[model samples]
Target: MDQIDLDLLATLEADARLSFAELAERHGLSKTPVWKRVKAMEEAGAIRGYAAQLDAAALGFGIEAFVQVTLQSDAAERFEAVVMAHPAVRRCHATTGAGDYLLHVLCRDIAMMDRLLRREIARMPGVVRTETIVSTRTVKDRHSLASAAKALGKG
Candidate 1:
């Protein structure tokens, strides 16, 4: 995408709830073009559906932990099955570093986290070891496309 498209995406990423007119005004464009560009971006899969970022603590999930999991086996099918079954795993990534998978989990409390680890996650086939680190503080947490773009040297 060109600079204008990138700029438009940046503004929208910051606040997807903004009106079309507002976006157009921010980008110094007419409403029609802004609407068309946004539509095109959406169709292209660059602009995914917007979502509200809620606080886990306020939602009854008082504990946040990053669990590093090591698997005895590296079979993709088995790993996919285990990861897909657990809804508490907010995000899971197959890594290239020391651990095979890193899972971001949200739980109601320490007890809940321990329960999930011992029962669900630890019991999964091929799991060799698990390391859990509870989040004491979140310095930065925002799912914005503009931040990604800037990181990639597009902004």
Candidate 2:
């Protein structure tokens, strides 16, 4: 991708709802070329898909928790599959640390969080133990990767 593509990515990252006309105006280009560039990006898998960023608290999930899960040696695949299918789990990562995996979960209340920790997650396939940290507040969340790409000299 060139500078125009990088700028387009950054622009789209800020607001995916922008129309091709708006994007073209921002980039000082015409609608058709901007649309073609976006289409190319999509076809190249640079742009996978887009969705609304929902408010978890507004959706009734007030409690956000990070769970560090340790599993039996051979249960990685089964544990991942179950975690992937679990509704409460928003994201999971396999990391090198004290725990085998990190899970981001949401619940309506502390009571629900407790149940999730003690019953649901603890009972999942091959869960040996889990340690949870309930977040008091989120300071920052997800952001665009455009800056990172530029930093990596890919832009």
Candidate 3:
């Protein structure tokens, strides 16, 4: 992608609701070209999809916790499949540490979180053990991939 494409992506990353005409005006281009560029990015899988950012806390999701999970030797696939299908799990990462997977989970309260841990999570595919760390406050939730790409000279 060129500088123009990178700029468009950065703008969209900040606010995906912006119209093509607005993006064009911001980038000093016409609507057609801007729309075409965005469409091209979408087709090429650079721009995956657009979504509305929701306030989890306002939506009654009060507790945010991170779990470091260690599974049995041959249960990675099943464990990951279950994690992917689970709704309360916001994000899951396969890591390189002693723990095999790291899970970010959201719940309505501490009791719900505890219940989820002891019931659902414990009964998942091959959960050997898990360590939970609850967040007091979210200092930072998600970062911009477009900005990171530009900073790393990958855009």
Candidate 4:
């Protein structure tokens, strides 16, 4: 992607609701080219689907925790499948560290989190152990695609 593409992405990252005309105006281009660029980016998988960012607390899910999971080497796929099927698991990453997987989970309260840990995660197949860190507050949670582009020298 070129600098114009990066700028378009950055503009969209700031406000995905902007109209094609507005985007074109911001980039000093016409509507058709801007629309085509966005379409091409979408087709290329560079531009993912847009959605509103919701507050977990407002949605009645106030508790958040990072769960570090260690699984048996042989049961990785099985454990991952279980994790993927659970709605509470917002994000899961396989890592090269003390833990095999890192899970970002959300729940109604501490009690709910406890039940999830005891009833689901702890009892999952191949789960050797787990460590959970509850989040007291979220200081920053920006999805910085623009920053990423700048870091990669694309912006």
lDDT of 2 by residue, 1-155 (tens): 87788889999998999999999999999999999999999999999998888999999999999999999999999999999999999999998889999999999999999889998999998899899998999898876787678768886
TM-score of each: 0.90, 0.94, 0.95, 0.95
Per-residue error for 46 in candidate 1, Å, reads 1.3
Best by TM-score: 3
- Screening candidate 1 with a backbone cut-off below 3 angstroms (N, C-alpha, C), the clashing residue pairs are none
lDDT of 4 by residue, 1-155 (tens): 88898889989989999999999999999999999999999999999899888889999999999999999989999998899899999999999899999999999998999999999999887999999999999998986686688778875
Question: Each model's C-alpha lDDT?
Answer: 0.86, 0.92, 0.93, 0.93
C-alpha RMSD (angstroms) for model 1: 1.8
TM-score between model 4 and native: 0.95
TM-score for candidate 3, please give it. Answer: 0.95
Clashes in each model (backbone N, CA, C under 3 Å)?
A: 0, 0, 0, 0
Global fold similarity of model 2 (TM-score): 0.94
Which regions of candidate 1 deviate over 4 angstroms? 147-152
**CA RMSD per model (angstroms):** 1.8, 1.2, 1.1, 1.2
